[model samples]
Target chain A: MWFKYIMVKLVLQNVSTLRGIVGVLNDILKEAKFKMTNDGVHMSATDPAKIIMIVLDIPRTGFDEYICEKEVELGVSIEEFYNVLKRANKGETVQIENIDNKLKIITTGKVTREFVLPLIESIEDAPKITTGEFSAKIVAETDIIVTAIDDASIISDELVFKATQGNFEVAAKSEFHSTNLNLIKDKLIDLNVKESAQSTFSIDYLRRIFATSKLAPVAELNISTNHIGKFSFSATDMFRMYFLLAPRTTD
Target chain B: MWFKYIMVKLVLQNVSTLRGIVGVLNDILKEAKFKMTNDGVHMSATDPAKIIMIVLDIPRTGFDEYICEKEVELGVSIEEFYNVLKRANKGETVQIENIDNKLKIITTGKVTREFVLPLIESIEDAPKITTGEFSAKIVAETDIIVTAIDDASIISDELVFKATQGNFEVAAKSEFHSTNLNLIKDKLIDLNVKESAQSTFSIDYLRRIFATSKLAPVAELNISTNHIGKFSFSATDMFRMYFLLAPRTTD
Candidate 1:
């Protein structure tokens, strides 16, 4: 038991990366299982309703100090972890260690603060998705998508994403108000269309997912007709996050 | 009735001044009666609990366009007025007119937005306080008091202000922690101690009042033993706001 407790210990030069990751996870999950391996820390969780799945990876190289004797799983309340991380100030170093069913977090700066949370029993592993054959992929500046989402949210709960041979569009319409954002291939960072496809998704989920858009400047979107939409972004070189959301059916 | 409708027509070059004024009033009164005269717009109201009285004055010179054919009493929900003012973008001009029984608020920018709120019957005029002779007065940088309030708020819901011949102190004590901020006469912008005095006040009220400290750079405080405390600040040259708060009894 003592040896197992010492197996996983890591220190982050800055807590913001983990904070952003936890912010995204906490939006879709109450509790999450994080797997710590020699390579990195990883988590894949699906909301209870099975409408969304989030996969996160933070490479071991990103940590200031990383030591893992063997692979280990740490299950914790995401909300609690996020709350503790939020207390960290800029330039503070965050240290994490596992000891006797407790997760210890220490932040060192001008002042040192420590918080502890009891670890819970590990839940069933998250099911991984075999990447589907997406008909179209579009890459755009994160601000464009974030701004489009904000504009659409003013009028409707769902947004329609359309990819055609020459342009991409995000639009929403209610009985009284409508907003449309059209980006031609020349305007986007990159755009690929095997065949024209359109999908509608909940603005609620997109809003939560993109809340951390400041962590990354660009996002890649994969979509197909009336199917799941996959969005991916890398925060600096430290970590990458992926979100899979099921599309809403339009009558 | 028709003549009264046209009596009050005022335009503010920048809505931010009124926004800041309404922000402070809305914190204390849900429904406020604003008296507009050729001199300016003024309001004096006491909280329902009678624990705090706020007097606000905005001179006619502050308004970009002041056309008052006659003095008019406009009574409206402070909350609704505050919400509409919040919608104004920076540099947007705000036009206010008493039309019939409604208050018309128009914001002109790149886009023009208009909101109408029905006027309600005016409440009884606020009771004016005859200035009292305080034994001590202290003038300090607003940042000092604002910071002191924030520090005390972490420990207790009430703060004790002690003024002596040479210095002044703001302090709070809780079961586990205590915070004290001591400022000597030389450290303050100005300090006058005719007779030493001490008073305890609700931190909740101070916190709300000081939230608008950005609008003012300095504040003056008057205190007497176990009596009302008067705190006043000017939000730029546009307005002067005074808060008179009754002290909390101490054992």
Candidate 2:
């Protein structure tokens, strides 16, 4: 007789990246599915209205200790997971263990905290988002984008992103007020505009995307004419988050 | 011809203390009455339910510049005042000038911001709380008290304070859980108990009182057996806040 033993445990030295990723996911989706394998962990979810989809991938090298004998899929409530992760200090290590049907989270800081979260049913058929060629690709500091989104949110519900020659402008207009933030080529790390593309999106979605600004110093933007826009935020070699947002037309 | 001139203006080195005091008042009461005299500024308010009363006093010496030709009383919405002050940086100097019917607040920091708040009719006869002799008096670090209150709040709706010869204890007991925090003589600056006394008060009131912990380092507690309790949180000689809470019977 032959038997195979299965062990699934992951320990991360710093929880800041995980916390930042979970914070953004909780804002976009209610429930998220995590796939843990020998390689690493992958999670993705779409908003209820299907306006946005988020994908998170963390390689095995991201964690201090990653042990997996067999692949396992865990369904979790993102909000609850974020709340539990919040209990860990910025520099503290977090140890996660698969216990029967619950996830055991052990955070070591000034005091060790143990939290057990019940697993939910994973979404078997999550919508797959395809990456296509874009007309404009811009790379800028995350802080600049976050600040622009925040300023635009105060004036209108919709924000327009326009990339022209050597300049990327974020603008919002309403009956009462209007705000415009212009990022010149000198300020941005990279700017590529094939034919000058502009798209309008809901400020609500953009604000949620900026929630992960702490995870990375900069964000790479891939903007298509009028279909979809993608923002990729990556931190060193620890984690990478992708936010896909659907464009809105001003009718 | 005889003319009388009245001018009331106060400039503080930092708005943090003022912000903390206003934050506590806004939670307890909707409107507050501020009286400015040669000595300083005094404000007090009672909760809508009359379960708690808060008093705030800032001496003239606390302000960088205090100019008051005649005593003036201004009625303000505590929430609005707090919201305006929130725009000021932590260490930014705030200049408050009574201009006709509005209070002008100028904050000097990275950017100068000016906000005008309309003054309303002052509450002429605000209820005055008399400080009575208490059976037990204890002084301890504000952080310890605040943490204990936060911990107790998670377990019960009421917290009991008991002071014996050399120990001060804060405990919360509920049907589901109980939490006790004891501060011995070594940990406290002063602990006096003429006779052992115990009192229970609503955790809701205690939590609001602790919101001002950032304004002071130590908090002085005056406990009168089963009657009322007063907590005085003072920051150096700049400001002092007093919170009087009505006790509840466990039975």
In order, the interface RMSDs are 8.9, 7.0
- State the C-alpha lDDT per candidate: 0.84, 0.83
Per-prediction TM-score, please?
0.53, 0.55
Error of 1 at A54 (Å): 22
Report the C-alpha lDDT of model 2 over A46-161, residue by residue, as the tens digit: 89999998888999989999987788888888887887777566776888887666676776654344566777865665787786788899999999999999999887888889
Q: After superposition, how far is residue B233 of candidate 1 from its true place, in Å?
A: 0.7
Locate the minimum summed-lDDT window of 10 residues in model 2 chain B.
Answer: B1-10
For residues B112-210, what per-residue lDDT tens digits would candidate 1 score against the true structure? 445667677857788878757998999989899999999998889999989999899999987789999999999898899999999999999988777
